[model samples]
Target chain A: MHIQVIPVEGLPIIHPGDLLTEMICERVTFEDGDILCLASSVYSKANGYIRKQDEIVASAEAVRIAQKTHEDPRFVQAILDETTDVILEDPFILSETVTGHVGVRAGVDHSNIEDGMIILLPPDPMGAAAGLQNEIARITGKEVRVIITDTCGRSFRRGQTGVAIGWSGMTAIRDFRGDHDLFGHVLEITEEAVVDEVAGFANFIMGESNNGVPAVVFRNCTRWTGHDNLHFNREEDIIRKALCKK
Target chain B: MHIQVIPVEGLPIIHPGDLLTEMICERVTFEDGDILCLASSVYSKANGYIRKQDEIVASAEAVRIAQKTHEDPRFVQAILDETTDVILEDPFILSETVTGHVGVRAGVDHSNIEDGMIILLPPDPMGAAAGLQNEIARITGKEVRVIITDTCGRSFRRGQTGVAIGWSGMTAIRDFRGDHDLFGHVLEITEEAVVDEVAGFANFIMGESNNGVPAVVFRNCTRWTGHDNLHFNREEDIIRKALCKK
Candidate 1:
C-alpha cells in the first residue's frame, strides 16, 4: 500500500486566536487512522505562545551567554526562560525544555513571525497534540493521530532535520524487543523512533521558508504498539553527561 | 501534490551475488524522478560486504575495548577495521567510517545474514548509490534518484531513525539560505537535510524486524539544490570535541 502525504495548503499566516484545527479541516479531508504533523511554531502562534522582545528583561546570565552566542541579550533571555537545563551556552544555546526535548535555544524561534516578537515551542507539546487530536475527532468525527514537530540539529550531522516534540494516538517508539530478523536472529536495533520518522517527512513537505505550509496529513499509515519514552533522562544519556563534564 | 511512498516487498533473502536493482525493478514499476531508498545492510549483503567472524584477528586495542563494551573481540575488531577515527570506545564503539559518516559500531551488522558472519556498510556509499541509479536507469529506461540508508541513534532522543549515508541525483541538503520566511526576515534555519528526511520516512515503512522490506520508493518528491557536506569535521563538531576531551 502506498501512503499518501498531503500538505495542508491555502491557509493564511497563522496568528494568535486563529482556529487552526478548523482551518486544517477545511483544507483536507481527514481519515480515520490518519496521522497529522504540525509545525510547533504554527501551533504556538495560534495559541498565543509569543512574547514581545521589548518586555523581556535580560538577566546577567543571559547577557553573558549572549556575548558568546553574539545574539541579542533579550533573545538569549527568551531562550533561557524556556530552558529547563542549559546544556551548552556557546556556539548555540543547547538546552532542555520542560518536556525533556533538548534542542537549540530550547526550541525558541525568531523567524516567520512579526518583527519584535518571538515564537516559542508549544509549552505543553504532548497536551497540545492530544488536544488537537480530540478537537479534530470532534469536528470531523474521524480518529486522527497528531504529532508536533520541531526542526533540530543532530550531533555529528551538519544540518537540521525535523523531530517529534509531541505525539498522540501512537507511541513515540515502535519497539521490537523480541522481534527477529529474516535469519531468525534477535534484532539488535530495536525501538525505532517512528514518530520522528514521520515528522521528518512532514517537515520536508512543509518547507522552512515562505511556502506557507505548516501542517501535513499522512494517509494509509500502518499502526504499531510501543512505549512513549522518547527522551533520555540525565542519568541515561552519555553524551549529555559528557557535555556536562565539559 | 501528495507524495506516494511505496515499499518494495517480497524478494528472496539476498545472497552475495543477488541483483538488487533487478529485483526491485521486478516488483516496482519504474517512474521518472522517483526517489528510491535502499537499506545499506541489504545493499551490502548483495555486494559481498560481509566478513567471517572466525577469520577476524582482533587487535590488542580491540580486545581491551571488547572487555569494556562486553562484546566479542572479533566484532570489536570488525568495527575497528572499518573505523577511521574512534569517537567513543567504552559504551559502544562509536566511530567514523571512511566515508565520513559517524555511527555506532561503524555501521557493521550482525543480523539478518548467516550466523558467524557480519555485514559491513558499503565501502563507498556515494559510489554505491550512483552505481545503483545508473543501473536502474539502464535496465528500466527510467531516471530515478537513489539513497543508501542506515538506522542510527541520536544523542538527546532515544531509539533510532533512518539517516542517509549516501545519495545520488539530489543534494544532501536543501539550502534555503537566501529564502525569506513569512515576515520577510533573513532565515536562520536555512539548510534542511532533505535526503535524511526522506530516508527517515522510508525507514518507517521498512521495519527493523522480519517484515522483509528493505527498499522504499518515494514518488512526487520535490527536488532542491545544496552542497553535499553532510558530515561535520573533527574541529567543527563541538560534541566530538567534548567526547574527545572526555
Candidate 2:
C-alpha cells in the first residue's frame, strides 16, 4: 500500500492552553485512517510546559553537573527537575523522564524556545495524543490516529530521527513474530515500530529548520488500524529493557 | 519542496550476481535529484551473502551463549563470527558488527531466506551504495543519491525501522549547529540524519509483509542535493561517543 504525507502548514505560533485541534482543523482536512503526526515541541508549548530560566532554582546536584557539562546551572536544574533518574553524567546529562523516556536532559528541549526559557516534554503525551485524536474525530467525523513525536539522538547512531513520544487510535507495534517470509521462513523477532517510522517520515517533511509545518497527515496507511493499544508505555518497552542491561 | 515516494515494482526474484541497476532501470525511469533507497536484503542476496546453517560450526563461546539465549548454536556461531564485539548476551545477542553497527545478532537477519539459511549484512555497504549510485547515473545520465537500508531493532525503542547502512551522493547529516530556530535561539545539536530518515520513509511504503516493492524512488526532495559525503562511519559517529561513556 502507498502512503502520502501531507504537511499541515500556516499554523500560528501555538501558545499555552491553545487548542491545537482547532489550529490544525483550520489548516487541513482529515480523512479516515489518516495518521496525523504532531511535533512534540508544539504540544509542549501549547500545553504551557515552557519554563523561564529565572523561575528555576538550581539544586546542589544541578550546580555540580552544570559545572562539568559547561551548561547554565538554572537550565541544568530544569532538566534535573524533569528527570526521574540520571542515566549518564559525563558529556551530558542523559536521564530518564518521569514518563520513562531515556534521553539527554530528560527529553527537555532548549532550542526553539524564547531566550532564557526551555521547553519540557508534554507532561502527559499519551493523554494529549488521545485528546487530540478524539477532537479531530469529532470535527471531521472520521477516525484518525494521532502520534506526538520528538526528535531525539539514539545510541550508536549519529544525528537524530523523529520518535513517537505519544500515540492514539493505532497500534504502535506491528508484530510479525509468527509470520512467514517469502521463502517460508517463520519470521521471529520482527515487530515493526510503525508509529516511530511514521514519526520519522513526518519529521523529514517537518524538517529541523523553520519549516513551519509542524503536523503531517499520512494517508492510505494500510496498517493504520487493527491493534487495540494506542500508547507505548516505556516501562514495558523493549528499548528500556535493552538500555537497562547497559 | 514536496517529496513523493514511488515504489519500483516488477523486479524478478534477485539472486547472486544479478544486476540490480538494470533490474530497476528496466521497470522505471529516473529523474535528476531522485533518491533511490534499496533494501539491504536484496543487495545481500544479490551478492550471495547467504549462509546455510550446515555451513556454520558453532564455537565454544557460541554454544555457551546459545544455551543461555536458547538460540540455535550454529546460528549463534554465525552471528558470533560476524560480530566485532558482543555488546549484550542476555535476552538476545546484541553485538557490534564488524562494520560498527551496534545491534542484535550483529545485524545477521534470518527472515526472508530459505529454511536453514540466513543472510549477512552487505560487506562494505558504502562501496556497494556508491557503486549502485554510479551505475544508475551511468545508465540514466542523471544525478541520483542511493541509500542502502536495513530494518533493524533499535536500543531503548520497540519494533524495527529502516536505517541507512550505506549511502552515496548526499550528505548523510544535516548539520544545524550554528543555525537559528524560529524563536531566534541558536540551534545546537540539531543534526538530522537525513539518509536514515529517507530510508525509514521508504520502508514505510515497502512494509514488512509480501509487498514485492523493494526499491522506492523519492522525487522533488529539494534537500536531496548540494552535499558531497554519503557514507556514515561509526568510528567518527556521535552515537559512538555517547555510548563510549559506558
Candidate 3:
C-alpha cells in the first residue's frame, strides 16, 4: 500500500474559542479512509489552554527544581500543575500528564507561543479527536480517522518523534497475534501502533519549525479500518503500566 | 513537503551471502534525495546472522531467566549472548544490544524465519547502512539516504513502531533550536529524528504481516540533506544518556 502525506496549509493563527473543525474544513477536503493528523499544540491553543508565565505562582518545589535545572520557576510551576506524577527530576523534568502521556514537563509546550506563555496539552485529547472526526464526517459524509499528536522524546531514543495522544475512528494498536507470517508460523507479539506511526509521518511533514502547516492528511492507508475493535482506552496503554512498574 | 512511501515488491526470499543491494536495485529505481527504509530482519538474513535453536548452549543465567519468564531456555540463551547489558529483568528482557540499542531481547527477532530459528541484528548497523548507501549510489548515480529499521516496543508506549538502528547519507536528527517559530520566539528543544520518522512511515506501508515488502522508498523529503551535519555519534544520543543516569 502506498501512503501519501499532504499538508493542509492556509490555516490562520488559531486563538481561544476558534472553531477548529471549521477552520480545518475550510483549508482542505477529506476522503473516506483519510487520516487527519493534528498537532496537540494547535488543539491546546484553540481550547484556551495557554498560560502566561506571570500568571503562575511557583511553589517551593518548583522554585527548588528550577534553580537546579535553570528553567523559569513559573514555567516549572505550570508544568507541575499539569503533571500527575513526576517520572524524572534531573536534566529535564519528565512527568506523566493528567492524560496519561509520559513526556517532558507533562506535555507543556514552550514553542510557537508568545514569549513567557506556555500551552498545556488538551484536557481530553480523545474527546477532542472524536469531536473533530465527527464534525468532519458530518461535513464531508466520509468516514475518516483523527489522530492528535505531540512531539516528545523517548527513554531510549535521542531525537524526539511524534506520538499519538488521542485518536478516533480507528484503533491505536493493530494486534496481529495468532496471525500467520510468510512461513505460516503463528505470529506472536506483532501489535503495531498504527496511529502513532501516522503521527510521526505527519510530524515529518508539518515539521517543528515555522512550517505554518499544523495538519496533514494521509491518503490510502487501507490497513486501518473504522472498526471499534481496535479502539483502546488510554488507561489500558502498556506504557502507563510500564511506568507504574518503574 | 509531501512524502510518499512506495513499497518495492518482488524480492525473493533472501539467503546467506546474497547481494542485498543488488537484489534491491533489480526491483526499484533510485532518485536523488530519496530515502530507502529496509527492515533489519532482511539485513540479518542476507548477512547470514541466523542461528538455529539447537545451536544455542544456554548458560546458567539464561536458564534461570528463562524459567522465570516461562520462555525457551535456548531462545533466552541467544538473547543473553546478544545482549551487552541487561536493562530490565522482569516483565520482559530489556537489554542494551552490542551495537548500543536498548530494546527487548537485544533486538533478537523471531518472526519471518523458520520455526526454532532466530535472526540477530546486523553486527554494525551504521556500517551496513553506509555500505548499502554506497552501493546504491554506485548503481544509480544518485546520492540517497538508507535507513535500516526495526520494529520495537518502547518503554511507555503501547505496541511497536519502527526505529532507525542504522542510517547513512543523511543526518538522523534535525535541530531547530536556534530557529524562530511563528510568533518569532527562538525555538528551544525542537530536534527531531527525521530518519526514524521515515522508518515509521515505511513500517506502516510494509505491515508486520505477510506483506512481502521489506523495503519502502520515500520521495521528496527535502528537509534531510546529504551533508554530514545531521550525523551524530550513537554516544551522543539523549536516550542513551538518560538510561545511563538510571
Clashing pairs in 2: A239-B156, A239-B157
**Which of the CAPRI classes, incorrect, acceptable, medium or high, describes model 3?**
medium
Ranked candidates, highest TM-score first: 1, 3, 2
Candidate 1: regions farther than 4 A off? none
Identify the leading candidate in terms of DockQ.
1
Kindly list the per-residue Cα lDDT of model 1 for residues A1-246, writing each as its tens digit: 689999999989989999999999999899999999999999999999999999999999999999999999999999999999999999999999999999999999989999999999998999999999999999999999999999999899989999999999999999999999998999999999999999999999998999999999999999999999999999999899999999
Give each prediction's DockQ, rounded to 2 decimals.
0.92, 0.49, 0.52
CAPRI accuracy category, model 2: acceptable
**Which is superior by DockQ, 1 or 3?**
1
Candidate 3 Cα errors over 4 Å, as ranges: A225-246, B225-246
Candidate 2 segments whose C-alpha is farther than 4 A from its true place: A224-246, B224-246
Q: What is the TM-score of chain A alone in each candidate?
A: 0.99, 0.90, 0.90
lDDT of 1 by residue, B1-246 (tens): 688999998978998999999999999997999999999999999999999999999999999999999999999999999999999998888999999999999999898889999999999999999999999999999999999999998898999999999999999999999889988999999989999999999999999988889999999989899999999999889998998899
iRMS value of model 3?
4.0
Of candidate 2 chain A, the 10-residue stretch with the lowest lDDT total is: A223-232
Name the best candidate (by lDDT): 1
Per-model TM-score versus the true fold: 0.99, 0.89, 0.90
